[model samples]
Target: MSVLVYTESEQNKFKKAAFEVASYAKAVASQLGTTVTAVVINAEDTSELGNYGVDKVLKVSNSALDNFSAKTYASVLTEAAQSENAQVVILSSSADSKYLAPLLAIGLNAGYASNVVAAPLSTSPFKVKRSAFTNKAFEVTEIQSETKIIGVSNNSF
Candidate 1:
């Protein structure tokens, strides 16, 4: 019922991509008449997430998770998404997210798409626009899954 966005942080500060992903997720949630829930790990300032239209935030702070591990991060994100019963999961196409998205998708049994440029065209059938062929072309993808995952390329919005 909500859109879950994974907002990655570095050195206790969130990257610009985090806000972008939250903003994108918020748009999707608005279209679906739901809310945006952001998941952050080791982030010092989660207040800004609300500025990006995040309705809620789940913060996981653990010394054991100080280092970024694709497997661990994906596992945590998958759990958060499931707990929220998120209809959509949004991540920025950062280096870390690129490594984590597919694993999270597999764990959640959701359709995954990368380099997504915009929000869904329609929630039903879940259509989205993606940049294809190295941004030289575009395609509309229809994801026929109950849950959907999107990796938005940096600066795509």
Candidate 2:
């Protein structure tokens, strides 16, 4: 199974968080012994993702997705993850990602971990370290589901 990452963009240009997530995905993919696949929505260029260790890029262009609708974005990501057979899905901790995370998790029937500060600690039991209580504390969470969704904190990687 591959590791899937959502690369967020604005005005057809990828945001900084996109690269951060891509890098984080690369680390996760290495731990999982798989490649990294990035999904870009309405982006103009995706070649730079390769520099961040993205193995494959899926570019999706649709006017209907120009506006940010949590439901619509979640649907698209869900489809990409399933098609890629992604066991782990990575997202940046942007506001839009936070909105989309739960929807995507429910759609994929995966466990959701937000504010992740680092790459997974273990892949067998699917454990990750995440920040809690406004980053004042940290917690180790184990996702029992076959599919896992991790929202990496901005600049954490």
Candidate closest to the true structure, highest TM-score: 2
Q: In candidate 1, which residue ranges exceed 4 Å CA deviation?
A: none
- Candidate 1's displacement at residue 66, Å, is 1.1
Predicted candidate 1 versus true structure: per-residue lDDT over 1-157, tens digit per residue = 7999999898899999998999999899889999999999998879988899999999999987899999999899988998999979999999999999889989999999999998888888789999999899999999998989999978977
lDDT of 1: 0.91
Model 2: per-residue Cα lDDT at residue 129: 94
RMSD in angstroms between candidate 2 and the native structure over all alpha carbons: 0.6
Clashing pairs in 2: none
Candidate 2's error at 30, in angstroms?
Answer: 0.4
Q: Write the per-residue lDDT of candidate 2 for residues 1-157, one digit (tens) a residue.
A: 7999999999999999999999999999999889999999999889999999999999999999999999999999999999999989999999999999999999999999999999999999899999999999999999999999999998889
Q: What are the models' TM-scores?
A: 0.97, 0.98
Residue 148 accuracy (lDDT) in model 2: 94
Please give the CA lDDT of all the candidate structures: 0.91, 0.95
